[model samples]
Target: MSRVPFYLLVGVLLVAGIAVTIYRHVAFEVPWVPGEQRQVWEVEAQVNFIAEGESAKVNLALPSNQEGFRILTENTGSSGFGLSFLDDDKGRRAQWATREAKGSQQLYYSVQLLVAPNAAQPRVEPPPPDQDVSWARPYDTAAKEVIDQAYRRSSDAFTFSRELARAFSGDRQDENARLLLTQFDRPTLLVKLLNQAGVSARKIHGLLLEDGRRRQSLTTWIQVFDADNDWVIINPTSGEQGRPDNLLLWEAGDQAALEVQGGRDSKVTFSMLQHNEPASVAVRNQLANDTLLNFSIHSLPLEEQSLFKTILLIPIGALVVVLLRVLIGIKTSGTFMPVLIALAFIQTTLFTGLAGFLLVVAVGLVIRNYLSYLNLLLVARVSAVIITVIAIISIFSVVAYRMGLNAGLTITFFPMIILSWTIERMSILWEEEGPKEVLIQGGGSLLTAVLAYLAMNNPWIRHITFNFLGVQLILMAFILLLGNYTGYRLLELRRFKPITED
Candidate 1:
């Protein structure tokens, strides 16, 4: 192709490759890099009730827009009931009704949570706008004494809140704490004290977001204003300040998350399934909400996906070879031979693969030198070397098996014919260019192969290549760009330095 067309093609490939990666990363939340962790949780709130004699109506509270998480999708499963959702001052509620009598009725509200980037930030909104925190006698007098003491010890609203939380948790042995704990639970007392102390405080019910939790009830905590007029979160149970990591605020005010009407017996429980996925995959999968994801390797069968994982990494190995040869001035036995060898290394593992390769080549080199004296034909000479290589491999395998090393079994995949050819070339080089040059070129080839293997086997590299096929186009574009270069290499610079100086 002409230079213009060639560069244009490379440019197109690079642009398209990058565009697809960005789109998938932003829109689908597919992680472009490997090893990033994201948590996607599937939560279910089940409302089961017994209905007899007449019809029944069930009103169950449903989770809606809350901080720390985003609801990707929601679903309901009810056998024989009409369902509708209503949003009012109380909270988001799901109402289910049936006209006829029934034995038992079950309803489910399920949500898939996509953890937001700011999920760790305290989910605190401005508290109710009012000021009726005056207290009643004796208890009022006791509350004033406790708040005044705690306030005197605290420097700011945050510290004051923590101090009160600490006192309520009973970690501190004091008369005030004893009286408060005896009167009410930590949650109720803390809110009452904070409101009485002129800080906007409210009792909020939340869930401790976790995996595999079943029949869990809401955890109660107190939200109050801090020194900066910003809301601060305090755990009544732990007596620690700030929102707990992975806490999802479920409801606020006095009403419970579930309220039942027109039903005799009512109960609500939660079931959660936690999934740990790579940041990108988890985000994308949660957003897609479909089993078969578009343009994702996840849609492929397990076997196919595994196969593609290795197959996609070849281009990366090839790129490593290109950089070593073109930019660094490395010499090798043959073009792409080390790449193929490195591929074998991937299977047999680096150490065993290298040891096996060197053993076969060393043994073959010795035998080929002996054959050289006989003046055998080129084809016959290569055939003898090939046979000798197999024998060496078989002997090594048997020895390794006896020695209790299982890695020796993978030597069969080492491309014996390539070893034979490498041995032949090295022998010729030793005879013509001398042993020193042979060693230099052979060592360079091994170094290149090891480098390529390292790049190919990287977790991030493997992930990107297999997960994002567009990355291969980017690699192709890069290789094409390198192909057009005619400048001196990094290693060549040293060899030519004296020439320029002179």
Candidate 2:
């Protein structure tokens, strides 16, 4: 059979295998909400001491019986506190008392309550605006000082307002609100200043649904309770001064600390212990019971998993490179140079990394050519080239450091051995085949590297390799087929045209 048809059939079979693998391992899930669900009850207690030698009262706010749950019992204790339990149908409420303290005291207690089928009835409190208290007031007083300093140093009222708006509401560009929130370095500082301004604010930390990465720093904002408008959000860091963002409002004042604390004591302990189980556990049993299957896959022998993952792709990439070289008549220094370069490209990414490799290789070649004039032996010449390459990298690192580009550090991962070998091969090719042949081979090597990078990085190829072990069979079939390809390459088409005419 003609080599063309043989290789073509092999490619087709390999593709088919990949398709089958994807189809078999696909996961499907039904979308359904559970009928029975656990609901969270928020219970908050605040103990404020007037800094005097007197009894401190704890204010407990319970969602009224209209909301559910009845007040079971109330009690007082000598732990320097009194407790009052109020229960309506919806949930239970606890009010505890404390003695005069130097600083404001916060007490958190929680109770597990049964969920009622009916909707919760609302509880009335000191209106929405009154509930907007600064949650971070006790954390640091310097946070307030920072804002005051920023406001004072601001150029004008307009500038101050803009800074404040950006700092508080994140709308520094707004002319009106910018003056209100100024120079605060952090959201926490802005919140403290807003609290001093009689605007309720707190530091809120939570994932912004827009993105999943947890913020390195706290996303601090102020929540103000306006009698008419309810709770509004203010981002002090958004603008110039702590200007408000159109009086942004939140449903629960953005005080997640208060909400989490409302559930239980200041410290809650949860422990899970299982004992008297078999000490000798099978790997398969552990794998089967593993909650996170993706991570459990790594527990398999590293060599087995690594080989299983990359073995299929290696053959596919090699086949593609070989086909390009043999059939397409592309030139390269060695059979595997392009493959190794492609593997290197995996680390460096497409454009920048490839460019870096090429640049390094070219420089190394120039140095190798210079060293050739000294009549160095083959081994000594290669060692010199390697040393020169390392020296070049060290110089590049120093320059990059001086330039303050941290990415320069990635150059350490570049394959110096590959570059040295390529330089020597290209030099030899240059001498024997001349520049034209050298160029052809060089171009081919680069082209193969590019192709290999694309094939290796293909999402479908990666997905199949990772999900199924059957992909190796497909790769094997391709390898077998490619091994037999004996047709004239595309580059040889013109050279062989005269023979076909006969």
Candidate 3:
């Protein structure tokens, strides 16, 4: 057979597996090990206001796809107040309504977010028409002076925003910036200047997430729509262009952060705490929001996930079987019987599975020797052996229960049909090739099963096979390569060694 097509197929499988594995790791930030943990922030917002004792309503801005954070869950707390979430052209908002409320009313909103290092940035939209700004007297002339100076130095919307901010920042400030700062806040003034210069700009609010922080207020930053319609964040005082990792945007649109009707002196404060959770949870949550995850194991229910966690390890056991039988010349009763036995060993611990297997096979051989006197047909003989094996397992289970040996209960995990076939094969071997050859093959099967169990039960191997689906393809490629190997086995090489005659 031509080896060209076979090697080409192997190469294709290998490359595909590697591409998928790398993309998942880099895109999702999925860890290579199960023990890796990710940081999470639990932030709580407190809205406090004095009520005028009438029907009260409060609306508060909610967090959305801000860069570097994935919202896991959000909840609102207010007694006797109905809460509902609204999504519109602006952004997400939570509104609380009550028929009647009195002095010192408080509403709470809590959000739990996972810190994702590779999270996609907040969505950007096309720039809206610039808001018309009319400044009075000297301020109009001063704003134009700053705008003209920034426009000369900038090439695009982003650079223009940077230059505009730089004109009013730190040591670069001149009379125009100081004059504008005297009346309007830095963020508002920057927004006005950018809008007057034909740039769509808005004031954005965010909270600085500090561990165990309490009673914090939102910080104002300017958001400018650049030439490509992408949103650019600029610090009004420092001329910085991007959001810091710790800044969590609370409001990104032109809408108000908090609005209260039938109430006065409305204000909102925030508190947050930092903690850690398994990174698998973050990946699972992130994938849950993606349509592509419908085919992933993470989308399955908990019970199915647990079941597949063991099922995925079967290929690893098969790989071990191929390596041992094909590469090392190990002989067993059946081709894949050792792999099945290794799976049983996972449910029943190694030592317990070994002892139970040896006991059943030893006792089963004795019964088969007696059945040979009847001269039964092959099918009937195999059927009788299966029934006998089941009976032995039942009797042993009852005996162990009475004797208070719980480990004996797991003996039922062994596959009855496989055990029957193994007993039949060993019996025929003994009758045809003698007991010496039977011991050789039976011991070899046991050794193969033990080695396979160690491989399948390994923590790292189990994690890799379950978390990365591409690993199965890689294993299949290796198995195909092993199948195509025509060289001498390790054991065969010793038997065929060249003799050095004296």
Candidate 4:
């Protein structure tokens, strides 16, 4: 191919890629590939109760400002009932009250949240004093002893609270800890001890975010205010200090999460599910509450989108193969054969795919060498090799399956005809150019495949290729430009060492 035509082609494709990328980003407002999808969660707090003929008042706790998340909007699924936010015993409560009510009622208060990067923590108020905490009989002495030990052994508020929590569970605990554990739950007792130590702390309730969960109860944990005004929360049972990454801080204070009046068998439950939303939708919603995801791939059927996700990365594999062969002087079996092999490796994984490919090719080569004695024609010999390669793969898969290796079954998708042809060529190369050249070419091919696999498997590379279709055209332009190189490759430079020395 003339270098001029190749250069012109590359220039054309490069322009096309850039132009399309600009159009998508400017006119359609598709986000840059990295910020394409936001981790958005839909969390619901549900209240169920039986209402008598008397007036009914149902109060439920609601989530406020939390870290690393921007609250989008909340839902109040209430019909024919009064809804209001009141400062009850709980810090903030969503009260649904009605007069002359009867029968069953289920209410949901849901919030949509988008996770943001490097989000700042919300400001927390100073904890209240431990009011009327005069313990009964021996419990009073136990509380004092626990607090004194924790404060003396620790240097700071966070450490002091952790020490006080640890004293209740482990064998190193004293009689004070045993007495406290028997008197109150671990979370409640931990806060009481921290308060006695003059550290401002409280017992807060939240739910560990588990997807598709229902009828979940609130879990209690210890939250202490340090000197610098940051909230230091800890798991009371394990003494592991820190808020859990996925916990939803629902409410604080001594009040229950849900309270019911003039009713029997009242209960509250929580349900939460998470979803990955494209930034296009977030942008649209931020613009004017547009429901459309705005011309993103998420608009496609999920099955088709998944297929496209894999198919789009093939160009990345091809680009890797081209760079290795053209610039680095790697001798692959066929021009793009290693690309296909590497693509398959993305599915079966590197170790399994390499082991399977070698096993199939090796057995086929041995079988073909034996058949060479029959003086077969070229067409018949190729056909025979293809069939033999398939049969060997089948038997190997069966044995691997019987042995409980599920990864082996994925090898069924390996291009059997290509491997057959590779073995045939390597066999011919072995006789004509010797085993040294055969080994060199085969090793080079395997190395290229491995490099290509690594490139294609990168999460950032996969994201860019699948989300931004223009990147594939840019990749094609890159491969085209690399194809026109006329100088010696990196490996070929070593072959001319004496000339360089002169």
Q: Write the per-residue lDDT of candidate 3 for residues 155-270, one digit (tens) a residue.
A: 99989999999998888899998999999988888888888988988898989999999999998998898767788789988999988989999988866899999899999999
Q: Write the per-residue lDDT of candidate 1 for residues 272-307, one digit (tens) a residue.
A: 998865675555445344432247676668898788
Number of the predicted model whose TM-score against the real structure is largest: 3
- Candidate 2: minimum summed lDDT over ten consecutive residues — where? 27-36
Better model by lDDT, 3 or 4?
Answer: 3
Angstrom error of the Cα, residue 276, model 1: value is 5.3
**How well is each residue in 285-396 modelled by candidate 4, as lDDT tens digits?**
4322323323345556779988888888788878888788788888988888888888889889999999999998888878988878899999999999999988998998
Deviation in Å, model 4, residue 24 alpha carbon: 5.0
Pairs with backbone N, CA or C atoms under 3 Å apart (clashes), candidate 4:
none
Please give the lDDT score at residue 22 for candidate 4: 69
| Poorly placed runs, candidate 4 (over 4 Å) | 1-9, 19-296
By TM-score: ranked, best first: 3, 1, 4, 2
- Alpha-carbon lDDT, every model: 0.80, 0.52, 0.89, 0.80
Q: How do the residues 164-277 of candidate 2 rate in per-residue lDDT, one tens digit apiece?
A: 545334332333223323433456555545555444444433212111222222244544443433343445455432323211111222433222222223321111111221
Question: For model 2, what is the alpha-carbon lDDT of residue 259?
Answer: 29
